[model samples]
Target chain A: MPPRPRRSYDQFCAAARALDAVGDRWTLLIVRELLLGPRRYTDLHADLPGVSTDVLASRLKDLEQSGLATRRRLPPPAAAYVYELTGRGRELTPVLRALAAWGAPELAERRPTDAVRAHWFALPLLDAVALEEGLVELSLEEGDFHVRRGSDGTVSYGDGPAPDEPDARMTLDAGTAVELGRGTLSVADGVRGGRIAVTGDGPLAKALRDG
Target chain B: MPPRPRRSYDQFCAAARALDAVGDRWTLLIVRELLLGPRRYTDLHADLPGVSTDVLASRLKDLEQSGLATRRRLPPPAAAYVYELTGRGRELTPVLRALAAWGAPELAERRPTDAVRAHWFALPLLDAVALEEGLVELSLEEGDFHVRRGSDGTVSYGDGPAPDEPDARMTLDAGTAVELGRGTLSVADGVRGGRIAVTGDGPLAKALRDG
Candidate 1:
């Protein structure tokens, strides 16, 4: 099939070019979903909530062409097509962090029209995990996800509790997590108020508790 | 007048919220234009080629409502409406940087449809300035601009040479600058190639020379 045309900015600037590739609607959020690891199409649609199936499929194809993501059939027993980010695609961790930091204040209140998901809260709280390398399982009122902050600087998270024992584990409500993410509440303040719970004897746990 | 509705993802996640504000077409490019300091509407139009007037106006209005930009008339002597980024809006610098860093490699070739502006190159090159807190005036074959890398980690640059004496001055062609921005070439490599000419004995200049 002929590729879908890209509505590029047609600018020589790097930022403009980046926007040309990922500036389309739902693209970065799709990146957010895959950052958690490989996900089947249905899982992505479930987490994203509002994107149209056609748009999702189009974006996945675009991401694949842009070399940001890849799609392949899973081997054997649990076979299904899945999409995952390439190393270059995973480099958006800092961009995600910056966006989360910039937008945390805007999240003062959830509108009646807003959809909620627990792992949706993961990107904002990823930086707070503070582990140089290791898995940190997060338990939230809505759900749980284990974020693996790599020493190489890519941050990835997967659904459910940590598959293996985690380096650190944190439990907090969405409300408190947002507050902490926004700096409306500090780590020490969250700990003092019992809004945040930290476990595990690892440095990240100690850092979270002692902060 | 009633505000135009925001086409949000309707997701409560902060990154999603941010995307709701910025993910629109030309919104961030507008931010990019304003980051060089206040710009007259016509000037912005000139610099941001390929943006339709209607789209520009809409993006500007959206930016204003989202608190990323503001519009105001200049004082009597040089009166003209100008748009500038708010402090909160300027916080996207890191996001811009990360995007630039990630997208730099894609700039391998400028397409036939691509437009070029000397200042458009400033944002990606801002970080290579290196000093903790200093101004580095860059003179390129296409034009000149000065970048101020603040101690607080904010990188802002403007058109023309530095208003005051810069800590360092470097003259290079845009091709070499692109290489440096893309990470394919280092500042040290550029200097060694004599593609870059650095002046002034300030720490930044000395560091660039030493590097």
Candidate 2:
């Protein structure tokens, strides 16, 4: 795709420059979606429920032009174009994490009109858990999702069931999950208090069970 | 003023909530201005060079409605309305710093079209210098500015000269200042190399001189 004209803050400040790139309404949200892993346009649209199709397409193009993401076709049986983050793009994960931590207080209440997805809580929940490496499938009242903690320290999560058999499976209500994300509740305490049920034969399951 | 209706992403994610509040164009830059301290409308307008007057007014109104900033009139002799950041708004400093650090490399080469401000480098330079507490007046070729390092761990910087006599006053060219902000050059090295001239009888000056 040809690059669109880039709008700039035009100031020499680094923060301003960063904001120039990602401060648009749906830009970082799109980055968050890409951080989960590569996804087809349909998948991204489905997961980010509120974004308009036009805005999503424009943001993906912007991400591509900015070198944060790229489109590639899958080989063979699953031949489909998907958007994925670049190394420079993945560096934005920390920036997203920082924003997530800072904004956590705002999630104390879910307004009557609020829309939600089980995977929208994925990143914070990933932060809440402590594990060196494992795949954990989470079953929340809202839906089911899976998270992977790589030995390389990189983490990623997606909606629905795990792409493969997960090392651990946890069942918890959305309230307990939100509490965990807010740091008001701990995974150990949740497990100990029986608010969270763990099932699996992996080390992660053993740790949760022992807690 | 009555609150304006807010537009939201409708998601339950903290980062998304934050974006709903500050993700608009020029919102964070306005936050950047308030971080310097209270500013009259004219002052904000002058510092933020590119924002349209209509947009600025709308953003200020949005910021007020969001509890990020508030406006009040100065007492007696200085009876003027000024906008300042609230504690909630001030908490965004670390977020800005993270973005600044992450975006520093984007600042390596100044585009001929880029706008320059001496005080714009203040936060990054403040990060560059290691200090417990002191007021440092910095004279850059672009302009003069001052930075305050408070004992309480709060720091602030403003355009133009120090409000009062400063503990240390250092003079250097804009290039050296940019280098300092980028962390490519240290204060000690700049001092020892005679690129930076430090003057004053205070401890900060003495440290800069002895180095």
What's the TM-score of every candidate structure? Answer: 0.96, 0.86
Model 1 alpha-carbon drift over 4 Å, by segment: A151-154, B151-153
Question: Residue by residue across B62-117, what tens digits does model 2's lDDT show?
Answer: 99988999999999899999999999998887777777766776787788878878
Listed in order, the DockQ scores are 0.79, 0.63
Which fraction of the native contacts appears in each prediction? 0.74, 0.76
lDDT of 2: 0.83
Clashing pairs in 2: none
Q: Model 2 chain A — which ten-residue stretch has the worst lDDT?
A: A123-132
iRMSD in angstroms, per model? 1.0, 1.3
Across residues A64-179, which tens digit of lDDT does each residue of candidate 1 receive? 99999999999989889999999888887777878888889888887999988888787777777654587888899789988886788667778789999998888888888898
lDDT of 1 by residue, B47-142 (tens): 889999999998998889878899999999998898999998898888788788877888888789999888888877876765557888899878
Q: For candidate 1, what is the lDDT?
A: 0.85
- Quantify all predictions' global Cα lDDT against the true fold: 0.85, 0.83
